[model samples]
Target: MELEVTLLGTGVGIPHSGRAQAGLVVRAEEPLLFDCGAGALLRLAEAGLSPLEIDVVLLTHLHLDHVSDLLALAKARWLMGANEISVFGPDGTEAWFEALRSLYPYLEELDVSITIVRPGDEFSLSGLMIRAGEAVHSLPALGYRIESEAMAAVYSGDTEPAASMRKLARGADLLIHECSFPEPFVVTNHSTPLWLGGTFRGAGVKRIVLTHLYPQTVGREEEMVRDVRAGLADETKVEVGRDLQRIGV
Candidate 1:
């Protein structure tokens, strides 16, 4: 089966002209949405896709920047007469969705199934194998490793250096990690070049795409990539991700 990822949105909570909030569309077996943060629908449309084409959404966490558009997707699909959506996310996900429905009573009319997942959970959807990894974020969060055939890719949400992330990315074809800052500005929960570089050390990831970029990284993209490259072994491709970039897996 073919596997590819379209970075629908790559910006952080703070807005940037060329970037949007965190989101991705992974085409594997079927179209799966990784996250649906604010402005995700706009980017998806710009990438020539429709919410009706997506039926499964795998959320890494419940952070607003990662899930703001969660209801928007369901509403769009409902309006388009698409299939009912199934959502999988870390613990408290069901509760979060329940609360969202309370505020938007109209969404309660849509059919959305929410499945709560935890770290270390392994499951299958269609032909793809997926595993969840714990992330070292401020709150409980998860990272995902998705494998299809012999190809594998890991998407690590906003996090700091975590051993679980390293284990998940080991020998993977692609690692999409968050690089929230360039350097010198120490951060917790979020990742910087130094923190992100440390997480990649010895992980054996073939290619690294940096996303969830904050405005601070606007001018220092090259330096950020350079710093992370220092921690990875030679031959590992590293690049700062941009919105709407499509990556093959």
Candidate 2:
């Protein structure tokens, strides 16, 4: 099976040019969408994909910047004559979807199934094995490790540097991590490159691509990569993710 990851949007909650909110697509037998943030639909279209093509949507958390596109994708897929899409998320997912449905009565017309997951849960989505793990964030968040026959990838969704993330990313072909700010930003729920490097130091992952960049990191891309490299071993490849960038898993 061919596994490829496309970064739809790399920005965080704050608005920034050239980067939308956090969203990514993992293309395999059936494309799986991860974190459909604000501009996900638009970016997906730009990536030469249709909203209806996504059969599975995996949400890491309920933050607006990470899940705002769920409703948008639902409506768009409905209009495009698609019937249902399975959505997987943390404990509050059902309640959050219900709240959104209450706000928009038309959402009731869309056929969507919600699955609530917990840490350490493992499931199969379109031939890919996915394992959920805890993410150190303010809300109940999850980081996922996805494995196929040919490759493996892990996504750190809106998390601070944590041991769980390191374990989940172990031996992954690629690690799509969040680099929300530069060094010494002093934040609890988010990660800075300087703080993350120590955590990823000596990690076995083959490559690491930093995403979810905030405006604070606009001009410090090189510096951020350098800091991450400083914490990692000499051979672990690190790169800053750009919108629409695609890499094989």
Candidate 3:
């Protein structure tokens, strides 16, 4: 089996040149989507992938920066002659989708499937097993660990260096963790490289790709990388993710 992961959007809520929002596409046993933030559709098109190719859309949370393009994907797939699409997310996901669909009464008749997932929920589809874990964010958010026959990748969506995230990413081939702030941001519900560095110690993760970078992290990229490298004893590869960058697992 082969696995490819694409970083569609690596920015946070705000937009920037050469960066979009928080979205990722994982192509393995199943074509799974991580988040559908702003500009996700455009990034998908840039990657030469159509919305119809997506089999599942997995959301991390209900934050607008992470799920802004949900409706756009649904509409695109509907127009492209695809059948019902599956969307899995944390609690309140069903209500959120229902509210969005209400805005487009025309789509009410379309075939779309929305499944609400909670922490510790395990499910399988298209020869892949997905497990949802709790995230250290404001609302009821979740991080996912997807395992196929050959490899696995874990995605941490807008978390603050929680133990659950480390547990979920244990021994994974790739860990797509968030590095929203630099150091000394004094913020909650988001992570800084300093904090993440401490949590990543002895985690045994193969590689770390930092995403969801905020504007504050613009000039501090090198410092973040150095700090993360200093903390990990294992020779873990660290890279700052960019929009449309493709990674193989």
Candidate 4:
């Protein structure tokens, strides 16, 4: 089967000119979406993909920047005559969706389906196996490792340096991790090049793509990439993820 991954939005909370928020699409046996931020649906449309083509949507956390477009996508699919879309996320997902439905009375009566996920759980859909692992973030968050016959990818949803993430991404073909800050910003609940680069070096992942860049990352991309390369050795491909960029594994 042909496997492809697309970076829909690489920006953090604040959107940039060529970047949106946090979103990615992994297309294999079935299309799986990760993190539906503000402009994700539009980005998907730009990629020529319809909401109906997405079978599953995996959320990293309950943060507004990560899941702002959840209801919009759900409602779009329902209006387009598509079947219920499965959603996997942290502990509070069920409650979040319920609260969202309450606001949109039309959605309450829709035939959409929701499945709240927990960490350390494994499941299969569309001939692919997915495993959810723990992520160190403000709220309960998860990182995912998706595997199939020919390729595999690990997505680190907004997290600080966590050993669990390294274990989850070990030997994966691609690791999509967040680089929220440049370095030495002294922020909590976010990753910086200093922290994230060190973790990636120890993790020894193949091909690291940095996303979820904050505005602070501006004018410091080269330095961040340099630090990551210096830590992980030259062979590790460190690239800044751009909106609408596609990669095949």
Candidate 5:
């Protein structure tokens, strides 16, 4: 069976027309939420899912745009009397989450288990296997490679150009990458089309859906797509991702 993937929130910290923050859902026997950003919880509801149904949350990093909704999810579940939730993320996740809990002592009643994962680590959830790789971001971050019975998908959390991600995503059926900017741009810790085109080399990616867009990409979506597509296989499917879009892998 194909794993259902939903792009709940596909924008950056900045506001955009219909875009929210960074988030996605990969559904297995149990739904798994990735990066509970500012608007992801609401977008999740819009996508015909409830925060209550999500028992696992996987974080790529601790950036605000990636984790602003962490407490909100906890509170929502607690309010609805849902079961406890588990969170998996890179190292320092435990300490960071503890700080959030300390600020909201009233949420202490809700039980949340956080597991710290590092680059090169692998873990299994439901019927899928997930492997973590390094990401080139300002703060420490990770990209994920997820595999099910027949298909594989990779998510580039928030990175510039990462060879580790390329290796992890080798032969992936789907790639949800963060295209933060367009071409002719000099940037660090975030990807431009030119940078990403070169970065995905040798990954043998089959399908790509770009996300984590910033306001600068407003009128240049096609150009961005064209740039990235030029570097991929002729049969590779590439498109700019939108909020609440669903795909199968």
Candidate 6:
């Protein structure tokens, strides 16, 4: 099967007309969801997919923008007569779910399995090998590298450029990175083109899809791509990712 990726929501925590929130679907033998933030379920539908079809969810962190749709997805699946789903995330994932369950109480009834992972852990799911690496963010975060037999993709969750992320993305066919702002904005725990491009160049990534765009960054796509091009090798392809855009890996 071809490794395919669909950008479900390319927007950041902030709302935008063209973009939703942080979400994507990776299709290998099975469809896996990464970072199901606000409006993710609706975007999944827009992508011509059903929430019940996604059994595995990989979260980079517990940021609300990256996980606001967790409960919504669970409820949707439950209503559809599917209950079993697995979640994998960085440390504190289980505890965070527990806290949510405590407040909602009904979450306890959802048949979901939560796994807490640490940096450097490797695991297999849906015939794909996935590895996690530390990410520099406001909270404990992880960047994921997923590989099939001949294809690979890396997701740089909400993070600043870091060595671990660079190592994880090295040689990947596609690097889906979060570019929350344009150059010289200097936001904490997020990336601008200047920092992201250097990391992408250092990793020698072949193709980059910039997601997690903030409103201010939407109209500056050309400038961001130009800045990244200035830092990266000419062979490296860079493009702005939009919701529902699909690419083959």
Which has the greatest lDDT? 2
Per-residue lDDT, model 6, residue 162, is: 79
Alpha-carbon local distance difference test for all models: 0.88, 0.91, 0.87, 0.85, 0.89, 0.88
Q: Per-residue alpha-carbon lDDT of model 2 for 1-249, expressed as tens digits?
A: 779999999998899999999999999888999999999889999999998799789999999999998888888888888878899999999999888878988668777899998989999998999999899999999999999987889999999999999999888899999989988688998898878888977778899999999999989999999999887746888899999999987
TM-score of each: 0.96, 0.98, 0.96, 0.95, 0.97, 0.96
Question: Cα deviation of 167 in candidate 3 (Å)?
Answer: 0.6
Instruction: Name every residue pair that clashes in candidate 6.
Output: none
Instruction: Give lDDT tens digits, candidate 1, residues 54-133.
Output: 88999999899999998888888888886488999988898888887889776667777888888899999858999999
Could you say which candidate leads in TM-score? 2
lDDT score for candidate 1 against the true structure: 0.88
Q: On residues 1-249, what C-alpha lDDT tens digit does candidate 5 reach at each position? A: 589899999999998889999899998898889998999989989999987898999999999899999889888998999749899998889899988889887888888899988899998998899999999998889999889879999999999878888898889999999999888778999988767877786678898899999999999999999988776535677899999899988
Give the poorly placed runs of model 6, Cα more than 4 Å off.
none
Summarize candidate 3's per-residue lDDT along 1-249 as a digit string, tens digits. 668999999997887788888899988755788899989988999988888888689999999999999889888888887758888988899998998899888897667678888889999876788899899999999999988878889999989898999899888899999989887788888888778877988888999999999888898888888777776756999888889899999
Error of 5 at 127 (Å): 0.6
Worst 10-residue lDDT window for candidate 3 reads 225-234
Q: Give the TM-score of candidate 6.
A: 0.96
Write one digit per residue (lDDT tens) for candidate 4, span 1-249.
Answer: 556899999987886778888899998777899999989989999998999998688999988888998888988988888748788888878888888889877676666556777878999877888898899988899999988877778999998877888889888889999888886677777777767777777565778899999888888898988877776754788888889999887
Weakest ten-residue segment in model 2 by summed lDDT: 103-112
Clash pairs (backbone) in predicted model 1: none
